[model samples]
Every structure is written in C-alpha cells, then in structure tokens.
Target: MSTALNWLSALDHPEFLADRVSAALRQWPDGDAEAVQVAEIDPAIADTSALVAATDITLESSANCLVVRARRSGTETLAAVLVLATTKADINTAIRKTLGARKCSFMSMDAAVEATGMEYGGITPIGLPQDWPLLIDERVVAQDQIVIGSGVRRSKVRMPGPLAQQLPGAQVITDLAVPIA
Candidate 1:
C-alpha cells in the first residue's frame, strides 16, 4: 500500500467491490464478512506478477483464479479453480481427470469474463456462477490468509484462507495444484 493503494474494510466500501462479490460477502455466515478487506490498485498492474512486484504482497499470500472448460462426449463443463500464486494449477492432469474429460483447457478471456461477470485478470471464486463448481487447491485454504481478486481489476480482496472453502459449492481438492517446480 505505497502511494497507490489504501487497504480498507471491504464490507464498508461497496464501490470497491463488484456487485456480486459484495452481495456474496454480505451473505457470509456470522460476522465473518468483516474479516475481508480490500485495497484499490491500478488496473494496469492487476496481473499477479506486476502486483507482487509493485506492492508488499508476497507470492505466497496471493491467489490466482482461472476459468477452465472441460469437454467430454461433446458436452462442455465450466468451473473455476483457485491456487496460490506460488503453485501452478494441475489443469491438464488432476483437473482433467477429475472432470472425466477427454480435453480440458482454460476458458478464453472473453468467455470467462462474460460468464463470470468479472473483469478479466480479476476473476475470483467468491461470486462465480452458482453452477460452476469451484475447485480450490488445499494449499490455498491452509494458508493463514490470502489476497485474491475482488471480481474487479481496480481492487484486490484479502480474507482468511479458510473462508475460501465456504464459498458456494467450493471443493478443496488436495493436490489440485503442484508446487512451483
């Protein structure tokens, strides 16, 4: 939070959060919603590498969200996956096998943004379509806290890692991703 960003309680700043994300947060059980925070960032640096290099955020504390499409028997299924920045998602192996798909790949940027109602480079699992099963790597949920997209490129959201598993239909898959190797 140098000259460009100021972290604040996300629940207190609806403007900084995507409409869907804000609504989801408000629905969180108990008062856990207060545990999340947000900080504005230059959209140009919203990509993980640039954001990490520009701020105090560390790779371990950051999470990346990806939209995946798997196809089998001419049927396509879309899902959202989240992993820590230090690890690579095992989309080609674990995910593909899990999906029982003959082929699987990331959804195109345009398709992902359109389906998620989130800005590209700022997709988060929190407000994903209710039909999309969210796959979050176990490592991400084990962390003390994580910094992830707020469904908008203009800001990032921070929350306790365990909260991620509470998102609607989230599946905490062990070995869903491999360590950065």
Candidate 2:
C-alpha cells in the first residue's frame, strides 16, 4: 500500500492530456470543469479494492471502470462498465442484455489489457477504442464528483460523473442494482 512517485504525473506529456480532457470538458455544457483532478498512486500494484482502501477519500464518491468482453455467436466485443466504488457492476445479466447476447462473460485479463492498450487497473473511458461499448451505472450521476482511473494505474482523475458519461462512445445505463445500505 505504501507508494513512491505521484501516479498522475507519471503520464507522458501530461499537459497535453489535460488539454484533451479540457476540450471534452468544454462540451459538457452543464458540467463544472473544476471538478477534475489528477492524483497519483501505484496503479499496477493494486486492484480496485486495494486502490480505494489506500486513499483517504470516501469510497461512495469514487467511480470505477471495469473492462469487460462479451461474445455473441462468434463475434467478440469489449465493453466498459462504470459503477460507484461502493457498488459493483452486474456483468452477467445486465451486460449480456445490453449486448443482446444469449451468453456474455468477462474476457481474460490478458485480452482486456491487449484490447484497451491500458493496464488493467488504469482503464478509463476517455480514450478507448470507438468500437468498445461503454456502460455507466445510474448512481454515478447522483454524485457531485467521482474519482476514476486515469488510463494509468499510478494515477487517477476526478471529474463530474456525467462528464464521464458523455465521453465519446459512452452509453450510460442503470443495469446494475445498488444493494440496500
């Protein structure tokens, strides 16, 4: 859990990355651009649970992205599931229905990593392939701000949840049922 470098700053040409997210922010229309921030941690060393536990931030206020792969007949596709950190996405039923596949399941870790060109813990919706499906949990919209993977494990980015919904190729959904607290 102990860490050394600032994770977020590890990105190459961070200013350029900021500019990209900034451009997307401008299109948000109702978004508060100030909500986004870059934080650092050991992305490669931790799973979502460990990453969340290592931070002082509230779990309910963060969003996690899970890269999922589903197959229909002989065709294989990739989808990203976004959910509140306090909850987990229901990939079995929800994702299957969305993909209209009689059978849907998660891809192997190796395939997910290869498809997204992102390390497992660092996958985000911002710069994913256009063909990948993006599914977001409805609860994310209820938050004022949410933390998400910054496309790299050692770093994270925070922003208005809706902004994440509006990313190109993103399709927000409430398929995941939030467990009663």
The candidate that wins on lDDT is: 1
lDDT of 1 by residue, 56-163 (tens): 888899999999999999999999899999999998899998788999999999999999999998899887888888899999999998999999999999989998
lDDT tens per residue, model 2, 1-181 = 5343243321333542333343444454443444556776654544666765676656787687777767888887778878887876777788778877767766677887787776667766666776777888888877887777666666677677767766767777775636536
> In order, how many clashes per candidate?
0, 3
lDDT of 2: 0.66
TM-score, one value per model:
0.95, 0.77
lDDT of each: 0.90, 0.66
For model 1, give the 10-residue run with minimal summed lDDT: 1-10
Model 2, runs deviating above 4 Å: 1-35, 44-46
Error of 1 at 5 (Å): 4.7
